[model samples]
Target: MNDQNNPRDAESDYADRIKLTVALLGKNNKASDVMLARQLGRNVLLEELGAIEEPYRALQPYEIDSNQRDNFAVHTREDIVMVYSLAVRANEQLYEIRSLVRILIALLFFLTVLFFISVIWR
Candidate 1:
C-alpha cells in the first residue's frame, strides 16, 4: 500500500513537515506558532498578544492544532506562555495563602494564651 493511504503514515508525514517548518522558522520560533500563524493569520497572533488579558488569551481550536479532533496534538507558544503564567500565579497565590494561615494561627495562639492568663488572674 502507498504511504499516503495509511493513516499512520499520513500523520507521521504531517508531524515531520511541522518539525521541518518549525526548524526553518529559526530556533526562537516553535511549531505551534507556525501552525497558529497559518491557521489564524499572522495578525490574530499579534492582536492577541496586544490585548490586555490576565495570564494570556485562551487558545482557539484552530490555534491549538490545524487538525482538530485528533488525539495527538501540538501546542502553540501562546499556550505554553499561558500555562506558565498560570503556574506562576498559582504559586504566588499559594504563598499568600500560606502567609495568611500562619498569621491566623499566631493570632489564635496569642488569644488562647491571653484567655488562660485572664482566667488564672481571676
Candidate 2:
C-alpha cells in the first residue's frame, strides 16, 4: 500500500510537500531561495507576512479545497515569488515545446504528402 515512487497513492504525500512550501511562505520566507537554504540546511525568508491567515484557515484539517491550494500556491508570498519565477521558466519551456511540436507536425505533414505523391506517381 505504500509506494514511495507514486505520490498519487491513497495518502496525499504531495500535501506535505505543498504544506512545507506554504509554511515557508506563510512565514514570509522566499520560496525561490528555499532550495538553496535547504541545500545549505539553512532557513529561508518568505515574502508577505500578512495574508497568511486566510490560507491557514483554508489549509485547516479536512479541507480539501483545490482553490485554496491554488490560492496558497499563488497568493502566498513565497509561493507567488516562486511561482512567478516558475512561470517565467514555464513560459520559456512552453515556447520550446510549442516550437518542437510545430516542427514535428510539419515534418509529419511533409512526410505524409511525400508518401501520397509517391503512391500517386507509382
Candidate 3:
C-alpha cells in the first residue's frame, strides 16, 4: 500500500532491498561471492517491483578501504553488472554440486551391488 512515487517510499524500498540482499548473501569465508549473489537477487526483485530508479546502497562503505572499495561498491552501474555475473556463477556452482551428488549416489549403489555379489560368490 505504498503511495507510489514518494521519495520516502523509494528510500524505504531501497533499504528493504539492501537488508534482504545482505541476509541472502549471508557469510562467505572465502570471498564476496555471497554478497554478489544477494545483490543480484535484490536487483532482480527491484526490477520486478518496477522501482529500478536507483540500485540499493551499500551497507557499510566507510569501513572498506580504497583498494577494497571494489567489493563494497554495490551502488554503481558496473557493480550491478558484477552482481548479475556473480549470481549466475553461484547458481552454476550449485548445479554442479547437485550433479556430483547424484553421480556419487549412483556410484555408491553400484559399489553396494558389487559387495553383495562378492559375498554370494564367496
Candidate 4:
C-alpha cells in the first residue's frame, strides 16, 4: 500500500490532470478520432486518479521570445511535462497493483462473512 501521508504522492497526479486539461483545451485539432481519444483518455485518467480536486485546470503559458501564444501549448516547461508524463504512467501501474489487492481483500471478507453465517445457521 502507498503511504497516504506523503505529500509527494499528492502532487504527482497533477501532471496527468494538467495533460487532460490541455487536451480538452486544444482547439486546433478537429479530427473526431483524436478528440474522442482525448476525451476518453481524460476520463480514464480521472478515474484512475480517484476523486482529485481541480482535475481539469489548464497549465499557464510561460515567457518566450515571441509574444504570441503557441497553437498547442500545454505547459511552460517541456522537460517537466515529460517528467510528469512518466509520473502519471508510474502512478497507473501503482493503481493497478492496489486495485488487485483490494479485490482480494473483498473476496476474503465475503468468504469470512459466509463462514460466520453458516456457523450461526448451524
Candidate 5:
C-alpha cells in the first residue's frame, strides 16, 4: 500500500532522480536529456554542463566488489554536482570543510572583538 504523500520508497524514488544525472553525463545509460525532460519535466537536466562527470554518483543496480568504495554525499546543492568517497568515508570532506569554515568564522569574530576594544580604548 502506498501513502498518498510519500508515494514510493525513498531509494526507488532516488533511482529515477539519479537517472537524470546519468543521462546528462551520457554514461551509456538508457536515457537522454530530451527523454528525461519528457519523463521528468523540462529543464530537469542542465544541458550546458556538457558531460564533465566530475562529481561522482553511483548508478542503480549497484554491483559492488570488496574493493568498491562506498560513497557518501559531500554537500550537494540541488542537482548540479556532488562529491562521494570510500571507507564509508562519504561525507567527511564536506564535513571537514564546514568545520574549517566555522573555525575561521570564530577566529574572525575574536579579532573583530579585539579591534573594537582597542578602538574604544583609544
Candidate 6:
C-alpha cells in the first residue's frame, strides 16, 4: 500500500499539474525546450513536494545588468496565467485574420476570371 504521508506520493499526485505549469511558463516566456527542461529539473529538486507553487519564479529579476534589472517585472501565477491566456487569444485572432484574407483572395480571383471571360466573349 502507498503511504499517504510519503513525499513521493504527494509529488506523484501533482506531477501533471506541475508539468502543465512548466509548459505554460515556457510558452509564455518563449523559452527553448532544453532551458525549460533544465528549469523543471531544478524545480523538482529544489521545491517542496506537493502542488506546484509559484512556477513563475524562474522569470523573476536577476541583477545581471542594470538596464535589464530596470525592465524586470515580478509576476505572480495569476499574472502569468492572464498573460498566457491573452497570448492565446491574440494568436487565435491572427489565425482568423489569415483565414479571412485567404477567403477574400479566392473570391477576388474568381471575380477576375469571370470579368475576363465576359470581356473575351463580348
Give TM-scores for every candidate, taking all chains together and pairing residue i with residue i. 0.41, 0.38, 0.40, 0.31, 0.31, 0.40
Residue lDDT tens for model 5, 1-122: 22344444433444666575665667544555546445443222211121112112122233435443222122123233422235236567778889999999999999999999999999
Relative to the true structure, candidate 6 reaches a TM of 0.40
lDDT of 3 by residue, 30-84 (tens): 3346565565566554543444542232222224356545534544666679879
* Model 5 alpha-carbon drift over 4 Å, by segment: 1-90
What are the per-model C-alpha RMSD values against the true structure?
A: 15.5, 14.9, 11.8, 16.9, 16.4, 12.1
Clashes of each: 0, 6, 0, 0, 0, 0
As for TM-score, the candidate ahead, 1 or 6, is 1
lDDT of 2 at 110: 100
Local distance difference test, each candidate: 0.54, 0.52, 0.60, 0.55, 0.46, 0.56
Q: Write the per-residue lDDT of candidate 6 for residues 1-122, one digit (tens) a residue.
A: 12334334335434554576566765545464555556555554334322234334324543246543343333245557887999999999999999999999999999999999999999
- Give the local distance difference test score of model 1: 0.54
Best of the two (2, 5) by lDDT: 2
Which structure is stronger by TM-score: 2 or 4? 2
**Candidate no. 4 TM-score:** 0.31
- Residues 64-113 of candidate 4 have per-residue lDDT tens digits of 33432341243336646887999999999999999999999999999999
lDDT of 3 at 95: 100
Itemize residue pairs with steric clashes in candidate 1: none
Tens digits of lDDT, candidate 2, 26-91 = 645576356434522211111122112233332234343687567656655765688799989999
Which residue pairs overlap in candidate 6's backbone? Answer: none
lDDT of 1 by residue, 1-122 (tens): 11322323333434555566566665455665757346344333433432212113323323434354242233365567887999999999999999999999999999999999999999
